[model samples]
Target: MLSSYLTLAAILFCIGLYGTLAKRNAIIVLLSLELMLNAVNLNLIAFSKYGAIPSLTGQLFSIFTITVAAAEAAIAVAILIALFRARGTVLVDAFNRMRR
Candidate 1:
């Protein structure tokens, strides 16, 4: 059971990583980041449930991760909105010109 959960989490993480690295859209990138975070959370929960010590530490950490992910999403969305307003585009490649 633990192995299955870990396998699923691994698959999810890979998909999220691919989406984050390959997507052109900022929104999709942010969503992919969230997906990656969720995969981490899933792993944490699974370990918490299956570990020999059997404490709540993993779950507690997962909760904290979720809180951080929520805050990150909110901040990312705000930045994306501002960026879109300024440039009329949400493509990652377009952001490169901002360095100049």
Candidate 2:
């Protein structure tokens, strides 16, 4: 069951990665980011539940990751909104001017 959970997490992570890479919309990318974060949380929770309980490190890491993901989502959404306002479009290709 633990291995299954990890496998599922890996599949979800890959799907999210593909979505983030293949989509042109920033909102979709944000959603994909959330999905990837969820996959990590799943892995953390699984390991915490099945591998170790006395230390609680996995759980702590999960909580920390959750906190960071929330903050990242807020910042990313705000930046996406700003980009939309400035460009009037959320297409990834259109944001190429951001490239170094």
Give candidate 1 regions above 4 Å deviation.
98-100
Q: In model 2, where do residues sit more than 4 Å from their true spots?
A: 52-54
Q: After superposition, how far is residue 84 of candidate 2 from its true place, in Å?
A: 1.2
TM-score of each: 0.95, 0.90
Top TM-score hit: 1
Per-residue accuracy of model 1 over 1-100 as CA lDDT, tens digit each: 9999999999999999999999999999999999999999999999999977777999999999999999999999999999999999999999987588
- Residue pairs with backbone overlap in model 1: none
Poorest lDDT segment (10 consecutive residues) of candidate 1: 46-55
Q: Which 10 consecutive residues of model 2 have the lowest summed lDDT?
A: 48-57
Angstrom error at residue 29, model 2: 0.7
List clash counts for every candidate, in order. 0, 0
Candidate 1 CA-lDDT value: 0.96
Cα-based lDDT for every prediction: 0.96, 0.91
